[model samples]
Target: MVKKNDQLIVTIEDIGANGEGIGKYQGYTLFIKNTAVGDKVLVKVMKAGKSYGYARLMEIIEPSAFRVSPICPIAGKCGGCQIMHLDYEKQLEYKEDKVRNCLTKIGGFDKITMEPIVGMDYPYYYRNKSQFPVGKNKEGKVVIGFYASRTHSIIDTDHCYIGADVNIKIIKFMRSFTEKYNIEPYDEVKHTGLLRHILTRMGYKTGEVMVCLVINGKDIPHKNKLVEGLRKIPGMKSICLNINTSNTNVILGEKVIKVWGETYIEDYIGKVKYRISPLSFFQVNPIQTEKLYNLALEYADLQGDEVVWDLYCGIGTISLFLAEKAKKVYGVEIIPQAIEDAKVNARINGIDNAEFYVGAAEEILPKKHKEENISADVIVVDPPRKGCDQKLLDTIISIAPKKVVYVSCDPATLARDLKYLHEGGYELKKVRPVDQFGHSVHVETVVLMCASSEAGKC
Candidate 1:
């Protein structure tokens, strides 16, 4: 029987949702971290259960053929890139299987048409945005990096292979600047200190950068010097401060004070210009995002005569793209600020047919459909990881749009909601998984579903 601290050898058979290796020991499943599929490794049981247990990899007896030496030195220690050790091609295959498995097993789809996954040409340095937690190590020295796996403990690192190259310089500067100014790193346990995190956003195409310092207090000690130093960095267009005096794990606060330069940075996703602020919910991967949106646009199959509904549209990123081909587009988001940005994005792009609304998609959409009698020919939903609410799903069924394009980050939730819609007279069509966050277990999938009654018309 498996018990805590029991040493055993197991051959990894599969990868879990969080990139953990799943292997069986005498019919009992064990989940081991920092291990990959096709790997034979010695593991120590951490927490043993009846059917399954958690284990820690002690030694890799035989490395998998799909396993590769991670480019980042601290990739294993840092939780930012979970599957960096896996081959890129294998990673894509895993993601594709992940989506397919969810649809077949969870969504209960018998035979669903699936398209090949969209992957980045060059996967490294694709992240345009990075959030580095500022904390002190056990040795009492300041460290800036990501947290360890499932823990708040920060893993010190000088660079990340998946993030922008400028992030290295930013980290170096912050390390020295904090040391020189004696800036205290926030200790979440004690809830003290000034600097909590360093947030950065880079426009891959525009060459514009925005740096926002997340502080535990209202202001910084040496504000002018900090701004001067950060401004010296190339492509530095915006410098801002986010104040979160509360004792919480949340990174950014509601209040944002621009210290210098522009309030927001400009970026392009397939010719659609967007103004990104410190708090905006923009996709971190720009290159893959353009491809993802293009796939969504194709799935939407707009013909310039259909009125489209874009639910949970952040900064009108997808809405504007659809607006270019649709007769009119209505975007709904819970964040008022994102709605405002969406309106601004539409105006800047000279897209007059798109309209923005602020409120929960579930509530606002049902209300608009009932009260305003706003009907859509095609409905595009890019909901959060939780997927669309039941109320909104019912509304979509009642309205019976000709097509429903779902963009999801979580396959499980996507399958759950797709099942609900599939039962609601929507026929599942093409489904494509997009590798938005390479080296991570997370994947973005775009699915197209047409109303069963209107399938012939669509």
Candidate 2:
């Protein structure tokens, strides 16, 4: 029944919360991509494991009701997004169920309850920010696009389903700049190039956009010429240069120097204006972020007088929100630039009750607790895909805040963090999954945790 690279016909039994197809063949697990949960397909095993195997669907014998035609031509090959073929309503259910299952199956919480997932009003074009890598096409024409998820290669794109028109135009505009300079693409193996990345951020309501040009070297030849062209972009907040020469392929280039235009982008939410710099981390979707943050503030049960700690608070979005109602809010982050931006944002909004600290959550939180000898009523963590560090979870337990709000972009990491928190005597009282990016597997989750002694089981 099982052999190396054996072809097997199997029905997709279920879907993991991450949108990975779930199937089993003779007690061996198989994860196949681009297939719906109800589809029966013949798959060729790509890699076999002791317990689980990776596969690709070679033949679809029976199609599932959830399956729909994918609009993107490179949907399967590009690896940018899966579940694009699934119905929108079904996608919502899958994300919600994925969060619930994680609480029950992984966290082992008996009384866990979940609210309905928050569906986006306008899912497509929900992302107001996007970063595209600039490279060359087959004809050697300058092409800017996202990387192919499957191959880690460039997927030459003109207009992404999620990016706004302003960003698309900018990308198209970059072609001439790259061509004029004859900037060679940075090959990971060879490691030679001038250009690296083009990052763009736009505000849905304010109509302000920020674009940062990242290069592999500090002194780009004919930098003045490039600056002239980049500044010509209408409504461009910043057109600075980032110098990144590391062996790693991380999009961010170190040592950003102001070439022309402002160095930061101004993004507005409600009545508050937040300035986002080249290195600052902000939510790509501004429309849903308002909903996301407000819901989180409600879940935190903030009372304007309570002390709130926003961990990994990039540019202090949540801390500023809480500052409106809280007596004092402190945001701790490792990126000092982001902390500086947070400080500026607070000052800009006349929010004197908020402050920013620069450091990792796992280290800074405990130090603040011990050195300051203070306890917080609430804690909010909006961590990267890697989730909260274990040490930070331990510190959170020691501090024992009455309320904890966790915002995550990845479900698997969120679930892992939840398990750790559950072990630390926190119960998952409520959770809501919000889909900010449509036609993609991306989901944003907000979870509220309370002290088990005061809260009922669940």
Candidate 3:
């Protein structure tokens, strides 16, 4: 029970995952949002408990030297960007520290030295994709913005600090769209509306963009109008409509129909151009994606005529990339649509050395291991947030490749898989943290694994 008279001056000891100030009040830990480390501030207790207290910053008596003015005015209030207040370099440092801490503190595994965090060369224009939630403000005007942190409330941001120039233009363009079409905002309580989300992804190299509009119900009365209207917008490579009727918070919902333009997007990655369908998963930031894949290939240490197994290969991106470098690449995925897209992507790209299968990694990999007369020289696994299942990990251990390049989006899960792999005889060579998605807590990392106990680890 915090009172009016309670005042405390404390230093922010660390930064939390969602980019908050981590410290202690008395013997309990406290997490203060929108705060930086090395900042000495007086906080007013908002809610108090025996273990910890929630407090608001009364005054920053001593501010950190590293603290800088946040670029986005709605940064603290909006839940979009987290590290805008901290300098770009310092943000990378914080990410590195966070990864390392997750490895040691959470996973209880060590020995692999994490390389310096790779930051986006262009921070502000790095985000190729951004989703804006649509809502109606108190005045009943259409409010388009992101969800406030940890709440159902909305934060209407006129300007997103990290989005590309084209993205911002698209958002502004969409405002006219919502206004002209009279598209109703989705009401969470009543669960009725027309528009749900605006998803946009831009290609850095090709200058092409794929815009997807997620709607509420099946009866898209004016979808054709929307397609025709949005088609007039400049720089839009393709536009799609994905109808999501489920009462869930999952983004992209159920991809119902592909209206106007093409059902997919065409973008160039390195020398290859990929056909990205709405359901297909691709990295949001295109420029940083190039760097990330290049770094992963470098870490994989691929040799000519080597067979590489790409597990959880969405749309066979890694397989296509590694095709020319390796003798053959076998990509495995669970999503049938994605696998079909992958095969088509490979065929269109003239990548014959890559073959894709439609099944889960934990299901398909072991059968292939038994039937195939050959083992892989290199194995690359990029799983979703849940990480590798124990069965898949066992398969990986059994068919231990000469080198393993595991790409992870979740550090905690990555650390868990790493601990399992480390126990199974693979040695952690290095971890390279790539900031493909900046301003968010999510970190994309590439960990190289080498056989430590001789050539028989397989």
Residues 260-364, model 2: lDDT tens digits? 777777878777898877788788888888888888988887766788999999899888988888878989998888898899999999999888888887787
Return the TM-score for candidate 1, rounded to 2 decimals. 0.98
Q: On a 0 to 100 scale, what is the lDDT of residue 87 in model 2? A: 80
TM-score of each: 0.98, 0.91, 0.93
Model 3 over residues 20-61: C-alpha lDDT tens digits? 887675655676777788888888777667777677777888
Candidate 3 global lDDT: 0.79
TM-score of 3: 0.93
Stretches of candidate 1 above 4 Å error? none
C-alpha root-mean-square deviation, each candidate: 1.1, 2.7, 2.4
Q: Between which residue pairs do clashes occur in model 1?
A: none
Candidate number with greatest TM-score? 1
Q: Write the per-residue lDDT of candidate 1 for residues 100-128, one digit (tens) a residue.
A: 99999999998989999998899999999
Q: lDDT rank, highest first?
A: 1, 2, 3
